[model samples]
Target: MDISLVAGLLALGAAVGFAAGMLGIGGGMLLVPFMTMLFTAKHFPQEHIVHMAIATSLATIMFTSISSVRAHHARRAVLWRVVKLLAPGILIGSWVGPWIGAQLNSSTLALAFAVFVAFSGTQMLLDKKPAAARELPPAPGMFAAGGVIGVLAGLVGAGGGFVSVPFMTWCNVKIHNAVATSAALGFPIALAGTLSNIYFGMKVPDLPASSLGFIYLPALLVISLASVSTAPLGARTAHSLPVKTLKKVFALLLYSLASYMLYKAFG
Candidate 1:
C-alpha cells in the first residue's frame, strides 16, 4: 500500500472513530462512501466495491465499538440489561443480512445504502422525542426490534446505531443512555456482520489483492488502529457536548455522502 494511502486511511479512521463515539453510529455510515471512493481510486473490481467497502467498514467497527463502549461503560451510561436482551436476536439477524445483501448487484446495494442513510440522517436531524407515555417494550419486543436493527445494519455495513439510537430514544430512553447502549450493541452487530460477509464473499472471484473475503484487509488494519485511539475521546466528548446540535451537523454530512453514493450507483 502507498504511504499516502495509509496516511489518508488513518485520517479517515480518526474522523470516523470520533463520529462513532459521539453518535454511537460505529462509523460505518461515514466509512462506507469513503471506502468506496478509496477502492475505486485503487482500481478495485468495480462490481465488488460496495460489498468490499461494507465488509471492511463492519470489520473496523469491531475495534471502534470496543474502545468507545469502554468509555461509555466507565461513565455508567450503558444499559447492560438492554444490551443483553437485544443481543441474541441481533446476532441472528446480522448473520443473515449479509447473505441477503450478497444477492444484490452493486448498483442496487449502492442505491439501498443511499436511501437508508438519507432516512437515518433525516431522523437524527429532526431530533423528535417520542410521546411521554412510550417506554421500552418487553423482552420479546426488544428481541424483535434488535432483529430489525441488526438486519438493516448488516445491509448497510453499520453498527446498528443509526436505527438503535432512534429506537431506544423513541422508547423513552434518555438520549445519553441510548447512545451509550448503542455503542455496546455495535460489538455484536460488527462481529456477526463481519463473519457473515467473509463467509458469503469467499465464493466471489477476482477480488483485489490483500483482501480477506469481501474485506480489504489493509484498510481494515489501518483504519481500526486509528479509530480505536480516537473513540474514547469521542465518547468523553459526547458526555459533555451538545449532541443534538452535533447530530444535526452530522446529518448534513450524511446527506452529502448519500448523494455521492447515489451518483456512484447510477453515474
Candidate 2:
C-alpha cells in the first residue's frame, strides 16, 4: 500500500468525479484511461488490463452516479418517469454489452471505444437543436432508445449520457431534465456492466490481488471514495454554468477521450 499511489488515485478520482456530475456522464470516459494507466504501471497482464480497467471504472460509476443524481434530485431536475421508461432496455442491453466486449481484443475494443466516443464528442460540439414542437417518444420508443444507449454505453464503458442527453433534448425535454434523467440512467448501466465484468473475469488467470472479477478493490476504494465526494461539487457547479459553456466543455472532454483511445488503439 503505497501512500503516494493511493493519493494519486484519489486525485484522479476527484477530477473525473467532478466532470461526471458536471457533464451528466458516468465518468467512464475518463475513468477508463486513468485506470488503464494505473493498471499498466502496476504491471498487470496486458490481455486483461483494459478489461479490468473498464470493469473497475463501471463499479466506481455505480457510486458516482448516485452521488450526482442526489445532487440533481435536490434541484428537482431529475425526471423519474423518463428514467423508469429507459431503465428496462438499458438493463438488458447493458448485460449483453460486457459479454461481447470481453470477447474483443484490446486493440479492437480500444478502436471501437474511440469511434463511439468521437461520435459522442461530435454530437456534443454540434449541440444541434431539435424542432421546438417535437415531443418525447412513447414508451416503446423510449425503450428502444434506451437499448441503443445501453449497448453503446456498455461497449464504450460510458454512462450513456453522451447519447441520452441529446436524445432527450431532441425529444423536446428540457436540457436540465435530459441531463438529470441521464444521470439516473447511469445507475442501471453501471450495475449491469459491473456484474457482467465480474462474471467474465472470475475464472481468468493473473488478475491482480483484491480483485472482484474485473474490479480492483484497492483502486475501487480510493477512486470511488474521492469521486463520490466530489460528484456533488460537480453537480452544484453544473447548475451555475451556462448551457452553451457546459456543452462546449463536454465536447472538448469527449474529444480528448476519443483521441486518447484512438492513440491507444492505433499508435
Candidate 3:
C-alpha cells in the first residue's frame, strides 16, 4: 500500500474509533461514507465502491467492538442478560441484511443510508431526556428490537449502537448500561455483516487483489488496528463527560453528514 493511503487510513481509523467509543455508535456511519468517498477518489469502479466501503467498515468494527466491549466489561456495565436474549435475532438479521443490500442499486442504498442517518440523528436530538431507570423488557421485545437493529446495521455497516442505545434507553435501561450493552451487540453485528459481505462478493469480478469479497483487507487491517488502540480512550472520555451535550453535538454533526450523503446519492 502507498504511504499516503496508509496514513489516511490510520487517521480515519483513529477518528472513527474515538467517536465510536465516545458516542456508543458503531462508527460505520462515519467510516463507510468517508471510505466510499476515498474509493471514488481513487477511481475505484463506481459499482463496487460503496460495497467495498461497507464490507471494509464492518470488518474494521470487529476489532473496535472488541476493544469497546472489553472496556465496558471492565467497568461491569454490560448487560449480558440482554445480550444473550438479543443475540439470536441479531445474528439472523445481520446475516440477511447485506444480501438484501447487495441486491439493491448502490445509489439506492446510499440514499437509504442518508435518510436513516438523518432520522436517527433527529431522534437523538429530540429525545434528550436523561435515561430513566426501569426493568428490562420481555425477551421477545428485546429480540425483535435486536433483529431490527441488526438488519439496519448490516444494511448500513453500523455497529448497531445508534439503534441499540436508543431502544435500550427507551425500554428504561440506564444510559451507561445501554451504551455498554450496545457495545457488546457490535460483535454479533460485525461478525454477521463481515461473513455476509464475504459470501456476497464471491461472484463479483475484477475486484482488487487484496479484497475478500467486498472487503479490502488492507483497509480493514489498518483501520481495525488503529481503532482498537484508540477506542479505550473514547470509552474513558465517555465515562467522564456529561453525555447530553455530546449527544446534541453528535446529532448536529450527523445531520450535516447525512445531508451531504443525500446530496451525493441523488446528485
**Which regions of candidate 1 fall more than 4 Å away from where they truly are?**
none
Candidate number achieving the greatest TM-score relative to the actual structure: 1
Once fitted onto the true fold, the runs of candidate 3 whose alpha carbons sit more than 4 angstroms away are 128-135
Q: Could you give candidate 2's per-residue lDDT for residues 1-267 as a string of tens digits?
A: 588779889998999789888888888889887777777787888888778878888888899999999999999999999999999999988888888888898878888888887887797788888898898888999899889898888776789898998788778787777777888999999999888888888978888789998788898889889999999899889889888888888888889888887887887
TM-score (C-alpha) between model 3 and the true structure: 0.95
> Model 1, 91-206: lDDT tens per residue?
99999888888999999999998998888789878888789999989999999999998898899899988889878887889878888999999999999999999999999999
- What is the Å distance of residue 132 in model 3 from its true position? 6.7
RMSD of candidates 1 onward, in order: 1.1, 1.2, 1.7
- Between the candidate structures 2 and 3, which one is better when assessed by lDDT? 2
Q: How many backbone clashes does candidate 1 have?
A: 0
Estimate, for each residue in 53-99, the C-alpha lDDT of model 3 and write its tens digit.
Answer: 88888888888988988888888988999999998889988998899
lDDT of 2 at 113: 83
Each candidate's TM vs. the true structure? 0.97, 0.96, 0.95
User: Which scores better on TM-score, 1 or 2?
Assistant: 1
